[model samples]
Target: MYRFSFFVALISYSTAINAQQIELRLHGCQTKSDKTYFCQLSNLGPIAIPAIEYNVTLAEDGRTFPWAEHRSGQEIAGGLEPGETMDLAIQLPTLPLRANEENVSISVELLPQYLPPPRPPADAPATAKTFANQVEACFNRSTLSSAAANGAIDVNVTGLKIQKVKNYVTDDAAAEQLFQAARRAILVCMSRNGTADVDVSLRFDGSGVHGLPSDY
Candidate 1:
């Protein structure tokens, strides 16, 4: 009997060691006229959590009805780390009964998926024009198209656009090839300089690339 009890205790200890502890606290919630609620979800744990699964219910008139069941992870650029919080927009299905803020209840479960890899320290800040010039130089050296050289560059926080001064390569397929090459060059430049990622668009025609604002 003593041996059996020792084994049971060992098993219990192991289980406790492997168990994941998580907490969910709601800060504030707002209900819209269309049965949508904006709420806050917080992660109160020692480690990062990749995904959050939650069920929201409405308790009204002594009866409970399921409002929403949602799983979110990728909404956040990186996984939700310890002590981090995210905004959640939850919509409820229309029902004959009416529910208000006081009647809502939520239960959250944390999924222990793989943790995100550690990121390198950020590089020193540089102006958008400087980054754009570096990318243009890299593209000019990497591509075979002469028209790609000395292209006008526009860079913003989210996007980069390059327009050739002269359309030397008129073929659509050849222009696309140049664009692909330019894309690779931009990626390499970003890695070398430790710059943030941005979308790249190429214009073979002399016209400037549209859609990006000049004020940026």
Candidate 2:
């Protein structure tokens, strides 16, 4: 009966996750070369997961740009490992001229799909248990890190806004760890930029949770 109960719980949890939504955020753009548009793709919320892939494309009107090459999918294997986020940067090919003065309709889709489980109650045991385990989980993940492993790309749009997304963390230690790394990167980039402060809001979502919860 114990094994049966555990099996039942596993099935129930998997089903709930399969219905969850994958959140893809277009933080904004950075011009790398004279003609390349380096777009920032962020897997926002529930938590990052490994083996997840994304396809991004840019279009003008109903037609796609031939010059725009869809780069290879970025994989966040090793998962977000709870209270962790990965930032990826992709530089898309740009035409000699801007396609449209109006905002270009850019689309990003997560392959293999994602469904976030419904939010658990504030007092749920899983929430309480996972809270304390996040940092340790991240540490374990440090071993799985690829030399190429980098978090979602930070976006800096000239004269517009700075959409600064805070790293997800369950505690101060985890938060500080992420902050120090980010600060170092920003300092390096600041030497080439005009300014760093751009007003933006905090938008939270499941990084790429799979499936929805039964309750929600």
Against the true structure, what is every candidate's RMSD?
18.9, 20.8
For residues 177-211, could you state the per-residue lDDT of candidate 1 as single tens digits?
Answer: 55566566666777777765554332222232222
Using TM-score, give the best candidate's number: 1
- Cα deviation at 102, candidate 2, in Å, is 10
> Which model scores highest in lDDT?
1
lDDT of 2 by residue, 106-165 (tens): 444444432222343344244223322331222222322221122211222222333333
> lDDT of each prediction vs. the true structure?
0.43, 0.35
The residue pairs that clash in candidate 1, if any, are: none
User: Against the hidden reference, what TM-scores do the models get?
Assistant: 0.34, 0.31
True lDDT of residue 18, candidate 1: 45
Candidate 2: list runs displaced more than 4 Å.
1-21, 34-43, 62-71, 93-107, 113-216
**Cα lDDT of model 2 overall?**
0.35
lDDT of prediction 1:
0.43
